[model samples]
Target: MRREDDHPKEHCAIFGIFGNRRAAWYTFLGLYAQQHRGEESAGIASSNGKEIRHHKSMGLVSEVFDESSLDALKGHLAIGHCRYSTTGSSLAKNAQPIIVDYSRGTVAIGHNGNITNAEILRAQLEAHGAIFQTTTDSEIVIHLMAKPTYNNRIEGLKGALKRLEGAYSLVLMWEDELVGVRDPYGFRPLSIGKIRNAYVLASETCAFDLIGAKFVREVAPGEIVIINKNGLKSIKPFPEPKRKAYCIFEHVYFARPDSLVFGENVHNVRKRLGKQLAIEHPVEADIVIPIPDSGNSAAIGYSSESGIPQERGMIRNHYVGRTFIQPHQFIRDLAVKIKLNSVGDALKGKRIVVVDDSIVRGTTSKMRMRSIRESGAKEIHLRVSGPPHKHPCFYGIDFPSKDELIASKRSVEEIRKFLGVDSIGYLSLEGLLGAVSFDKKNYCTACYSGDYPVRFDENVSKFATER
Candidate 1:
């Protein structure tokens, strides 16, 4: 498991490919490209049109599957999942591409977001004598499918989907077809692509790029696409939501810079955010630097807008795995040290401005700033590319309780003092909304503004599955 990061933890990633003889291999490559979204576990399920096969394990994609494992999963249609347990324990059994043998042949689902009403639905099913195999919110869909009143399978799937309350970008596979669906509000991203004779579905366009797939388009909000030997068909099963709530964090932090999500390129949007941040809060400094990869694009925009030259002031150790064994407390203190190191030569006696994405709990930012100061920086100013995170996300992204978020309780000056930085500036809410290419009203600023489009029960934590 990863330590509490400086930003909210990514929800999950899902990918699927149809009509490929080497479906599992290609799905593996797609999941590898999306590993940054989730690293707790990886899984893939493939079908030969008669039956479905799957392999899942509790580790990174590379660690979970090898030559022998991938070779065993031969099929024409495949769906893969990489998970970060937002509501349940991080067990291998919970790893997805959740395959089940229902009455209408076998089906597997790779899900990318949380089902807010999982507990309520699970209870209702169990009262009807349902016995669940796993404690993930995603399993509720399979159970609902098994008990649907509709005779037609597509209608049944649609019925099951309509019952879901919150975020979901799903890729489902059965004997002869592949289906992809996004919730009505589009709380998570899902994309379509094509390669050779195959059709593809994934959490981001970056995955499609990895396997040489042509960019198609985003699976529409409240839309479902079904692919078979016949071709692809679209289904609009649910009523339109009151308004769209595309997770704005995807542009700020969650997505890979190379991906196109929610109608724009993530890198370009982030650069606009940086330039806007500089225009909103210009700081006079000797040099501008990014925390690392996530902050790189924004730093560039900041440099160009503020006339401050940007350089790599911090070096990242990419080899550091999510978990490591530390024999002593002294070694444990080096958690931040293991992942990041200050470029001392660049920082010595310089008035530095550190451009970072966001500050979640303030712990990581404090550690980073302390490290930068110790490297002989005379003045340090921190610039954030997004607004203060004041609420925990119930849609998909995993944030700690509201009290754990430093910005939730502290003012700007308080946070500056806590981090020991000379000054701090966060991008304004107006600046953030302006940076996105889509309609500002369509994006979710719930975490920043506490305007949740969908409300969850206060007792949400009781639902182990969330199922």
Candidate 2:
């Protein structure tokens, strides 16, 4: 069965290290740091200049690899992946850092985003008798790279990348070369770092910090960065888009608060959003409380801006399993109940304001509100840092269908009533953009505005090609 959550799920995390004797070890650490990005499965592939070896399974990073497994993958060039499966089902066969032996030696790929045109491209390739081993959109790239028309590996890679549409931040290793590529529109985050003489690539900078790597810069949009013994070289083969579409949700919720995403510190950006949200919607309350982990920074900003004392009203169980195998709805509710517990002392008899990042399905939010009410809160006002998520996200976030979104059809008043909250306030789209430090036009708000930056076949369901 599929694991379900109220929040949007990130697709994957990719990490690579070159010019290091302990490349696999460093890659392991990097993926461990960004484990928040994906938790369904983890994998790592390494090249010892002549051969490529890999290990992957349907589990967390720590569960998938240990010292013995890392030691077996002997190489100075390695790439790793942790996935939550936006394009494929959560099965062992779909685990990544997919290795392929082809016309141009062996290459391993670890991808971070979704390919919107995968189904169309897959059909075209299938017509030509191309065989696929896995039901993942990422395999399409390897097949394209194996085409006979391209003369060299780099040319083949560029040709394949140009044909792809939607989000992709890839880490590819071919023999001794370690490469990273970002889509022209830059819908996902990828960064470059250096430790000693080694070059590192990862989905977020937090990975670099874990491996003691110095932050170099971000992989530019439409750029391919190649790192080998000779040093790092960059090439841009595709035409640039008119405007960049960096995922704004990275700051609002997806990314680790300690990481730098799209050239801005995530925690700082979230604080700004909270401050802006407070400016947009202010309420008189006795105490301000956050929804825990994701809501911590924003709640701080809200408390600071509103001049209300902030308290930890809810305690999160960090050790809770990602999913529960329950036979009944009540059992599932018990699983959710164990994940968070309301503090009666802080919330009891107090008019409280709860700050959260976003409300997706509203089921979890409703449960949380019920918990607060049971804790004796006199009044509860819910404030969201970002605008209501009304549409599905086709680019890497595992957002539910439009009908599944509570805000898709219901009005604010109806949603407030459904959640059993005194009032609900979501930051306006303008306010969300205002909080971002970069050009507002560069960020994608498709989940809120239904304005997709990269065009896709509207008729097809986002999961049409997934197995």
Candidate 3:
């Protein structure tokens, strides 16, 4: 079993469709494109203008939905999600889209990112006689909507949503209507698309391609889109104009290169970032090898700038499950060993430079370094494609506390000692902006620089205790 300290990664891709019989199928395709956002579980809910039904399970999209299950959820409107647990344990109850029944209507909701204030809200709700059925913060929405003080359910949701203080992109299904909302800072991505006569709401533009939908605009920060037979209505929940703090990591490591976010192409941005990294940290090496998947783009840039050939020296076993069989400590170390192996012939006697997206705790990097050394590499130079994470991520990422962050209190030389590498380099702060086409003034880099766009009291640590 994995250690308890290895907190389950929590993130999800949310999709919604309205005014289409093929919505359930289309949402399935959307979830496929966004599968990288989460991997622990997946689910879908559909509405036929009268009743809402759903199917959710613990697995990837394909494993969760077979031919029969997909067919069973036919509706003119639908919303889907792929889950990664954060707040609650990794049980079936934590899966999305979470469907609940109330006197007003049946609401199925899918959300991305964490709500920092969930525990306080939960306690307040319970004190007022609200009975909760799930430990998920997502369920808090049901209680918020069930309040009788509001004129209607939508207004009640808006009130509850306004009181929230952290990152979230919500997709709510109310009877026949499918609604999508983005937090004021747009810490998460959500977009609107069109598939012939239908409207689609998804976490990324790549989902549009999967469902044969034409890419439309993103859901503006603090904006909400309501879709039903009457058509789409937009709502802006935040007051005044606030600068957006879109997560910069979304372009750096999280999103698929094929996707378009905030009118910027992900693949192109990554290539540019690679070029910038090379300009900032020039290095001489026999070959530059990416750490696979996330590291590919930055590696290519490092290769082009250093005039070194880009070689696939390290190969990842795509079949490896997130959790490995580690019956003992030695076996656990071996589990990390088999996850990635070096291309022996490519690395023999060669001075290698390794590039990866980021190093969370340095354990994985140390293990990978050892793997390369075992393959008979003469020299190993490590290059990180992103800035050092000096602070914990309060939004959604599973980063460790400040004490656990190597960069938080250590210098480059110290980090090299911790990871056992000959030479180490990281992309510069400017290199971060060089990776994206958008203006630096708008993006969020709080995790890297400790300059949070939204100021919260230091007591914010108490939020975790509440959850």
- For candidate 2, give the lDDT of residue 313: 97
* Alpha-carbon shift of residue 236 in model 1 (angstroms): 0.5
Q: What's every prediction's RMSD, in angstroms?
A: 1.3, 1.2, 2.2
Candidate 2 Cα outliers beyond 4 Å, as residue runs: 1-4, 86-88
Q: Which number leads on lDDT?
A: 2
lDDT of each: 0.89, 0.91, 0.82
> How many pairs in model 1 have backbone atoms within 3 A of each other, for residues 3 or more apart or on separate chains, i.e. clashes?
0
* Model 1 Cα lDDT, one tens digit per residue, 1-467: 34725567786899989989999999999999999999889999988888888999998999999999999998889999998775456877788988888778888988887788888898999998998888888889988877647797788888899788989999998889999999999999999999999999999999988899998999999999999998889989788877999999999999999999998999999999999989998988999999998999999999999999997899988988766766677776778878899999999999998999999999988999999999999999899999999988888888888999999999999999999999999999999999987788999999999998886886776234633
Model 3 vs. true fold: TM: 0.94
Better of 1 and 2 by lDDT: 2
Error of 2 at 3 (Å): 4.3
- Writing each residue's lDDT as its tens digit, candidate 2 over 212-313 gives 999999999999999999999999998878999999899899999999999999899888888888899999999999998899999999999999999999
Tens digit of per-residue lDDT, candidate 3, span 46-94 = 9888898899988889889988988998788999999876534578877
lDDT of 3 at 67: 83
